[model samples]
Target: MSIRIPPASWAFRGFVLCFVFLSSFPGTILTQEVTLDSIRIFTTHDWFSIKPTVYFQCKGENKTVFPDVKNTNVSYSFKGEESWQPLTKLEGTKCKRCGIYEQDPLTHDTFDEWELCPSDFTAEGTYTHGREKEFNATFLCHGCSQVGPGSNKESGTEKEEERRGMRPAIVVLIVVLVLGVAAAGLVVGYKYWRKKKRQQEQARFLKLFEDGDEMEDELELQNTL
Candidate 1:
C-alpha cells in the first residue's frame, strides 16, 4: 500500500516557499521611504519680512511642511528619526515631480520644482539639489538603488548638468576644428604661393640669361660684318 499526500498540504508548502523567496528581496517588493536630509532657503516668497511657512510636496501627494525651516539662507538638517521624517514613499521605479513651496494667503509660492528619483541619490543614500536664488536641499532614501529604474536612469537635473557641461566642450572642440582647418588652408595657400614665386623667379633668371645670349649673338654678327 502507498501513502498519498493531500493537495491542501502541497498548496500550503508552496505558499510558504513563495513567501520565503519574496521575503529574501524586500527592497523590490516594498516602497522605499524618501526623507528630507537637509534644506536651505536662499530666498523667501513671502512679501513681508515675516518668515515663510515652507513645505515640500509632490504631485498628487500631500505636502510635508517644515516647521523649523522658516528663515531664509539658513541650513537645517534632519536625522530621519522624527515621526514625520520620511516625507514620502517612492513606489517602484517611478519618479515624482516635487517642489518646495511657501504657503501664502493668495497663492502657494514655489521655491523650486524638479523631478525627484531614487536614481538621484548617491552611494550614501543622499541627494542634493540647489536652485539659484530659490532653495538648496538634500534628501535621503536608503536602499533607493535597489528600487530605482536601474543604475542607468539619471535624475533630470544631473542629465541637464551633463548636457550643459558638454556644451562648452563641444563648442571649444568645434572652434578648434575650425581653426585647424583654417590653419591648414593657410599653410597650403602659402606653399602654393611660394612655389609660384620660386617658378617666376627662375623664369626671370632664365629670361635674363636668354636676353644676354641674344645680345652676344647680335654683337658677334656685327663683328662678323
Candidate 2:
C-alpha cells in the first residue's frame, strides 16, 4: 500500500504574468490559469516521473512546469469535489535537483542540471527573478484534482480562480445561446397547445348543446300525445 494525497476538488492554478516590454514581444499579466485536466493513477519506472506536478504556469506564451512546486501554493481535496486543503508552502528551497528549471547565463536556454539537473531550469539556490522550467517528460499527478468546466466561480481581482468558475467567454456565450433557443422552443410549443385545447373545448360544448335540443323535442311530443 502507498500513502498518497486522496483526490481533491477541482483546482484553478493562477499567478502573476508581467512582461518587460521586450521591444517586439507583448503580453498581459492577468493571473495565469491552469487546470488539472485529468490525472491518471498508475506506476512508472522513474522517480521524478512518479513525483507530483506542483505548479503549472504560463510564461511568455508558453506553459512551463515546476516540479519543486512546494506543498504550499498547492491545495488538496480530501472529500468530494469543491473541498480543498492547501499544501505546505516553501519560500526558497534548493532547486538544483532533477527537473528544476534554470536559465543559462551564456546560452539563455532552459535546461536541467550539469549532469543530472539540466541547464534549462531556474536554479532554486540561484536566479533572482525565479526561472520557470518545463519538465518535458510526462508524470503521474499524485493527489490529482479533477477539473470542472469552471463557469460559476465568483471572485474579485487578484482573487483565486476557481475550477469551472469562470468559463472562457466564447464557451459561455455558446452555452447561453443554446439554452435560450431551448427555452423559446418550449414557449412556442406551449402556446400552440393552448390554442388546440380551446378548439377542442368549443367542439365539445356544441355537441352537448345539440343533444340537449333533440331530447327536448321528444319530451314535448310525448306530452302532447
Candidate 3:
C-alpha cells in the first residue's frame, strides 16, 4: 500500500528523464539560433540554355548570418526582377561531420576513433552550414550558353573535325600505297624482259643447226673418191 510521488512530482519526473536523455544525443540539443528557412531555385533548360541553382534552407541552427536578427541574409531576383541579388559567400564551401567507429571485440582495437567530434563547417558559394541542405549557389544565366561536347569551344571544334576527317583517309591510303608499288614494279619488269628474250632466241637456233651439219661432212668425203 504505497503511493507518494510528490516533490513537485519528483521534480517533474526528473526533468522528463533528463529531457529524454539529452534529446537522444546529436550535438546535445542546442538548436534555435539560425533562420533562413526556405529559398529554392533550381531551373535547368536547353535550346537556348539556362541553368540556375540556389538552394538555402535553415531553421534553428546551421547559422551563417542572422543571429541578433536583422536580415537580408541571401537574396536573388529574375522573374521580372526588381533588384535583390545579394548572395556571395561561396568560398571553398564546407560541411563535414562524419566519425563513428567501433571495432574492439577483445582488442580488435578501434574504439570511437575520435569520439563525439563534429565541427568543421564552411559551405561557400553563398555560405551554408549544417541542417541537411545543399545546392548553395550557381547563378550565371544571361541569355544562357553552354552547348554540349563538353565545350572547350565544343572540344576544339571536335578536334578540328577529327583532323578534317583523317585527311581524306590519309590521302586515300597514300594513293593506294603508291599505286600498289607501281603495279608491283610493272609486273616485275615485264617478267624480266620475257625471260631475257627467250635466252636470245635459243642461241640463234643452235647456230643454224651447226651450219647444216658442216656441209654434209664435206660431201661424204668427196663421194669416197
Top candidate on TM-score is: 1
Task: Sort the predicted structures by lDDT, highest score first.
Answer: 1, 3, 2
Model 2 CA deviation exceeding 4 Å by range: 1-167
lDDT top scorer: 1
**Global lDDT of each candidate:** 0.76, 0.32, 0.34
Better of 1 and 3 by TM-score: 1
lDDT of 1 by residue, 40-145 (tens): 8888777766676888899888888898988777889889987767788875555778888898665568888887877887777888898898888989988776
lDDT of 3 by residue, 71-156 (tens): 12343323323222221121111112212111222222111111111122222212232222221222322211211112222233
TM-scores for the candidates: 0.58, 0.27, 0.25
TM-score of 1: 0.58
lDDT of 3 at 37: 29
Instruction: Please write out the lDDT profile of model 2 over residues 1-225, one tens digit for every residue.
Output: 955322221111101111222111211222111122222222222234234443322222233443333332232222212112111111111111222233222322233322111121232211112223322322222211121223122223322332233346436555655665566566667868998999999999999999999999999999999
RMSD of each: 25.5, 20.2, 35.3
Model 3 residue 175 lDDT score: 75
